[model samples]
Every structure is written in structure tokens, then in C-alpha cells.
Target: MAIKPSKGFIYLLIVAVFVFGVPSEAHAEPSYAKYGRAAMQETANRYPDANIIDYKYEGHFETSGARNEERFRLWLRGSGGEFGVRVHVYVAADTGQVRNVELEEIAR
Candidate 1:
């Protein structure tokens, strides 16, 4: 014969699950994602007429004096033409604030 759990015990279990939910591992967003957003926004700002067709994350690197850069290449199509731009989004290492953005046109 099998014994059943008491209603009070089942109630407690349901309450616990409702309050805490199921246990699961936490996932963190990659560091590049934040900087990548900046890159995308700046690219749009600079090339207002262009539509980004492709994006590639090249690398993340630290620069002099608490500065870091997220490098990416974006291909865009606009009224002017289709081209590629290498974007560098430099940010403050501690605060994640934008320090500078640099764009260079490249042959695609």
C-alpha cells in the first residue's frame, strides 16, 4: 500500500513553488552585447539613410586608460551604395559608458 501526502503538506509545497518557482541556473548576457547595441545605434545615427544588412562581431579589447573597444563589421545598403563599415565602440571599462565611436569604410 502507498501513502498519500497530507493536504497541508501539499499546500505548503504548492505555496513554496508559487513563491520561489522552479530552480534554474542563471544566464548572463555577454559583455559584447551592450557594446554591440552602442555600435548599432551609432551606425544608424551616422548613416541615417543606410540599412544594415549584416553584422559581424570581430573582437573585444582593452585600450589605454580604462577604455575598451568592441569591434564589429556591418554591411549596409543605402541610396549612396552598398558598403561595409568597421565600427569600433570604445567604452569605459568600469561604467560601460561610451567614450568614442570610430567607423572605417571597407571593401566588401
Candidate 2:
């Protein structure tokens, strides 16, 4: 004799397939994405001789009204050696208009 599945077991199996088979919706990038791009572009421009090895978004911080900062850390390799750079892109909190950018070279 062959083992057979009951009607309820078949229904549950079908439900499970429909529930977990389809892929989930795609995720959107963060609001501060523009600032991150600006950081990368500006860093590349400033250090034309250096090649960016890695990029990491640090976080967001509010300084004053309508002013905020997006922090990032970029690892770069140059003729001297490898080093880390902290790039800060300042922007308006509400509008996201870029105000200024500050780049600092950190000791490795």
C-alpha cells in the first residue's frame, strides 16, 4: 500500500507555495543617497592620483535648523600607501540641497 496525503495537507502545501514562492518587492535607496554619490565623486576628483578601494556610509547628523550632514568613510590607495578619508557632505535637512563638503584624510 502507498501512503497518500490528505485533502487538508494538500491545501496547506498549495498555500505555502503561493505564500513563499513569489519574490518580495524591491527596496529603495536611502534619501541621503545623493550625498553619498557626491562624496564619492568629489573624493575621486580631489585625489585623482588615489584609487578608491572601499566606500561606507557612516550615518546622518543634524547640526542646526535646515542643516544636516551625511558622513562617509572611503578607503583609498595611492603612491604613498593605503589610507582612510572621512567625507562629510552638508545639506539642507528638508530640501536636501547640498551646502558644502569637507574631506579629511585619516591616519591608517
lDDT of 2 by residue, 20-51 (tens): 88665545577778898999999999999999
lDDT of 1: 0.88
How much does candidate 1 score in TM-score?
0.70
lDDT of each: 0.88, 0.91
Q: What are the TM-scores, per candidate, against the unseen true structure?
A: 0.70, 0.73
Which ten contiguous residues of candidate 1 have the minimum total lDDT? 22-31
Q: Report the lDDT tens digits of candidate 1 across residue range 24-93.
A: 4455577688778888888999999999999999998878779888899999999878999999998898
C-alpha displacement of 104 in model 1, angstroms? 1.3
- Name the runs in model 2 displaced over 4 angstroms: 1-27
Q: Which stretches of candidate 1 lie over 4 Å from their true place?
A: 1-28
lDDT of 2: 0.91
